[model samples]
Target: MTKFNKTLLAAAVALASTQTFAAGFQLNSQSATGLGRAMAGDAIIADNASVLARNPAAMALFDEKALSIGATYADVNVEVTDAQFLGQDLGSIDNAAEGKFIPNAYYINPVNEQFAFGFAAFSNFGTGADLTPLTEVEGTISPVDLLGNTEVATINLNASMSYRINDALSLGLGIDLIQGSGKLSRGSLVEVEADGWAVGGIVGLAYEINENHRLGLSYRISPEMQASGDIMYLGTEFEDINIPLADIAQLAGYHQLTEKFAIHYTAQWSQWSSFDSITLENPSSPEQILKDYHWKDSWFLSLGATYDINDRWTVRAGIASDKGVVDEQSSLSIPDSDRIWYSAGFSYNFSEKSSIDFGYTLVVGEKVHVEEKNAILLPIDAYTESGANYFSIQYNYTF
Candidate 1:
């Protein structure tokens, strides 16, 4: 590749970094009940089959077959303002991010007193944004290589099993099949489309201190995804691309202080430091680095409370703090920042074996200043703000 072409390709790839709803590119829309509680103690809360999406060991708490189905609609808003290239105005963009609906399903069955099985379908990562109009500013030279449309999505299908050693402890293991797809383009200079699959796993432990208190710990191993499609590096094309994903670890606790009141909390960590870079590979040539992230690890902390109002009504509320993963290296494409979450929800029981849940959450992000170099090495500066509203509904049945 020529020097100019190489520079252009590197700039475009770097700016095409994933922009998502949660910290890094992770997704947290797996269950409506979990969302209502900001995911606090989700790994140990076995109130419904949705627990299968977090820690399968919780399935041991079930004595009957249970099923849960839910979906979350996320309305994302991102504003990019004060965009300039070497003092020349490049205008601003409003609502660059797109809204999406995330769906999930789970099933759990208890076999005998010591064994259980469960299955779940959900998503852990996704992103969508379009900033291409920033490149169409009339008067000045635009940062065409740094602004574009980028979308990424992934789905996880899991099969899990749990074994109860005794009344106090349970162990669980799960295998995951992940399907992912990505699309990115910058005007007429760059375009990439790819889809592929990967495999990963999770292990969990659930400890019950008593009938009213419990603790859970889990770790998820993620794979370095490789996809094949039309990946253009300048004028050259590559057969495949490799993108590294991060592992996750979480610890949660639940306490029932009163007959009708309960409290829960969670501490979760993401190993984003391991997501160092993206690489392009071809059979005829050596592997090449497509982009470097150099991101840091991140944490999410949540606290929640649940109360039973009546025989048929239950209410819950939660709060959370999410630390951003991006450190010194930041880009206009990502617009990453620290965030806070406020959530509330309710459950209405129709009968002893059936119920419905409704949840809502508001995610607020801090505004941040971003600076990056365009294709011609001209520095571009902008201020970005991102936020979202999540509405969720779920149906749960037990037999």
Candidate 2:
């Protein structure tokens, strides 16, 4: 690999590692209905087919055979400003992403009245952004070019089971295997390869209190993704690096104010603090690449309400505050900060066997400033990004 290409790859990892928008390293676009209420108790409620993406314990609620398949379309817009190179106006443009389609599938069956089992698949981590115009910047690389327009994708398969301990109590467990891959391009180098196997587990408990209230608690253990694939620059090898990802934690509850309406909230904590940086370990030369990052831990708090409009239609709306992964050492590669999400969506049951869903969400941008010390040998005086708008839709089926 040429020296320039190697430098770009090193910068790519450093920048890509700090980009964020979802929980831990996962993106939630599984069920359109799930999007309506900001996914409040999606696993515990199990009202629609998307329940499979939440707590496998929710499978217990599915008394009959059920299957849910869904797709979400999202329109994202991002903007960066206050950029300077040696104190010059480098200009700015919208880094917004193209509309993307995210899909999911889940199936559940009752072995008996006491036990239920299910299988599920969905996207966890995804990377998408536009940086074609960044190349024109002088002396400074957009960091976007080093990581390509898109950088990461993760697919998860979960086998779960739920057991009803009593009329008022239930317990659930799930084992998952995750697969991931990414397309990385920097300067004149591009690398594409499959990341390795990762193992994780999920456990949840739900309790029924009286007739007006219900409670739930769930914990999902994250598995570290250890990938082994050739790091290619143009046509040459640039030695591989070991990337370690973070885990997830969620706690939620719900209450019914009326027969036709209900409200719920969720608090999620991700161990993003475990993410410090990425290191490229080379055996031949006993040398390590230069790419260090300082990322802070983040959290999400969501509240949502659901209204049963009719037998075939339900409406839901929610709001969420997602903390930023970028810290004081943030870079041009990830020009973002904390965000506020306002969303609304609905579900229409076409029949007892099938349903379709749609959702729309707007994310209010946060005020985040940029400053990098060891990158590009310069410090950014200030940096910030405007918010984004998103639209989502999905289809759910049961048989």
Candidate 3:
């Protein structure tokens, strides 16, 4: 590999290792009905079997067997402007944040009046980024190797059971089978790929104040995910690197003010604090310290209202604000910032036992100024603009 490409690869790894995309590489497009309300009351809204993925305790609200299948498409746009490297102008470049389709499915069956069992297949986190635009700079001797792509994907399979204590309370427990994989490439100078599986668990509780009000709380624990794979860099191979995921906690409330109108809210916290740094080790050589992410915990809040327009149609609207995990450690690879969500949707009940839900969301992110310092090259100051539009549709059936 050319020396110029080598340096560029090093710089790319430094920026990409810690932050990939979607608010520190976490995905929020899990449910179509939930997205319609910006995920408001995600844990307490037991309108369908999708609740099994969000809060298993909500399964107590079901009296019959049900199934839910859905898909969400995210169209993301990101741009990096006014980038300077070693006092040289690199101009503006747009990142390839292509549209991604995320799919989900769930099944729930009631064993008795007070017991329910459920299974779900869903994706909780994912990201992909292409920086090929950075390779077209006019300079001949590129001091950095930022010409590569990175991608990460994960799927979660869960089995859960809920027990209704009485008319007003319920409890739930679940086990998660998480599958994950990742790939990073830097112009043939460095290529790394890995895949793994991990075990986690979820616990939840739900309380009903009356026919019109409900409250729910849930927590998810993520086990350490170790990816055993080979890495080829500079004509050398390294094996068995580890990657860790984070846990989450959620609280939600649902209130029906009248027969036709209802309101809901939620508060969610992600344990991003657990991700302090990115370290890659080699058995025969020194460790490669890519970055010190220094990310703090993150929070999300959402508020929504539902209006029953008619017997067969229901409309919903919502708003949400999500706090960024990286306060000062932002980079081009992630470029995550505080964001707001505006959403709207409608559900059509085709029959007593079947329904379809459609939702649309617009995500707007705050502009961020980044100043990344490099050991081999001068510091670069850049401005980033990021946003996304999401559309989703879900089908629900009850028997």
Candidate 4:
């Protein structure tokens, strides 16, 4: 590889470290029912075993053992327009990150009226994008460092226990065993891959004001994960680097106005401020900064309603505003911005013991502008338009 390419490659590697397109790389695809309602009142619904994934305290609302299995397909489209690299006009790259599938499962067992146990498995953060258009310089043979292809995936397993203290109050606790992995490749010259595990915990509380009103609160404490991986640059190896994940907290509520109508709301916060930078180091030297994230804390708010049409059919609708975490620092890897969500869904009860749910959501992001200079003296200026679509299906069985 050429010297100019090496410099550009370093910048690409740095930017790729923190470029997550989905609300700063945190996921809200835990349950299909939640997706139908734009994730409103996720912690208090307690309609199925999927509630174990959001708030274990909700398990106290169940009287029987139950299981839920679901999957979501996220189709994302990102476009870069009027891109200028070192003052050269380059048109655009469409569908930067196309389609990704996320799957989840949960189970709950109520041993008695006051005690319940449950478990859940799901994906918290994942992304994939291609930006090879920025790797080549216009009208020259020299290397220009733009973003390239990158992929990241994480899986979280949780086991929880809930105690019903009385008719109106419940408390829950759980532990998390998270596994994360990722890879970054820049023009075949620089490739780095790594995988590791991290431990975390969750605490939740739920209160029933009456038969028609309920409230819930939950907090997730996820510590930074230090991944031990090999970083290869131009055939040189740098082993033992660190990667970080953020923490989150949420408050949710559910209200039933009549026998056939109900509403839900949720307010969620993510601690993106904890993630300031990415560092990589070897056993022989001190740590080096890959990139500076400098992200700010963010919030998500949602409201939803459900209508019962008959004994077996129900419909749902909702809207939400999800804040972006980027703090004046946007890159070519993925343009991060605030998003608006519109969603709808339906459920059909096959019998008293089984049911099926389908949900869809549309996410539209505010236009974002980017202008940044890498160490190679190349400047990347571009405007990005981004959006996403989600389709999900879930099945619940009570025994």
Top lDDT hit: 1
lDDT of each: 0.82, 0.64, 0.76, 0.78
- After superposition, which runs of candidate 2 have C-alpha atoms over 4 Å from their true positions? 1-13, 16-20, 23-25, 137-148, 189-197, 232-239, 284-290, 374-376, 380-382
Clash pairs, candidate 4, are none
Candidate 1, residue 82: lDDT: 93
Candidate 2, poorest ten consecutive residues by summed lDDT: 1-10
Residue 382 lDDT (model 4): 82
| Residue 9 of model 1, lDDT score | 24
Q: Per-residue alpha-carbon lDDT of model 1 for 270-365, expressed as tens digits?
A: 998877887878999999986678889999999999999998999998999988888898877666899998989999999999999998989999
Task: Determine which window of 10 residues in candidate 3 has minimal summed lDDT.
Answer: 1-10
C-alpha lDDT (0 to 100) for residue 336 of candidate 3: 72
lDDT of prediction 3: 0.76
Error of 4 at 277 (Å): 0.8
Ten contiguous residues minimizing lDDT sum, candidate 1: 1-10
lDDT of 4 by residue, 182-210 (tens): 66777656676665666788999999999
The regions of model 4 sitting more than 4 angstroms off are: 1-14, 17-21, 136-144, 233-236
Could you give me the TM-score of model 1 versus the true structure?
A: 0.95
Can you give the TM-score per candidate against the true fold? 0.95, 0.86, 0.91, 0.92
C-alpha RMSD by candidate, in order: 4.1, 4.5, 4.7, 4.7
Q: Can you rank all candidates by TM-score, best first?
A: 1, 4, 3, 2
Candidate 2 positional error at 48, Å: 1.9
lDDT for position 370 in model 1? 89
lDDT of 1: 0.82
Model 3: per-residue Cα lDDT over 332-375, one tens digit each? 55567888999999999999999999989898888888776554
User: Model 3: runs farther than 4 Å from truth?
Assistant: 1-21, 140-147, 233-236, 282-288, 375-377
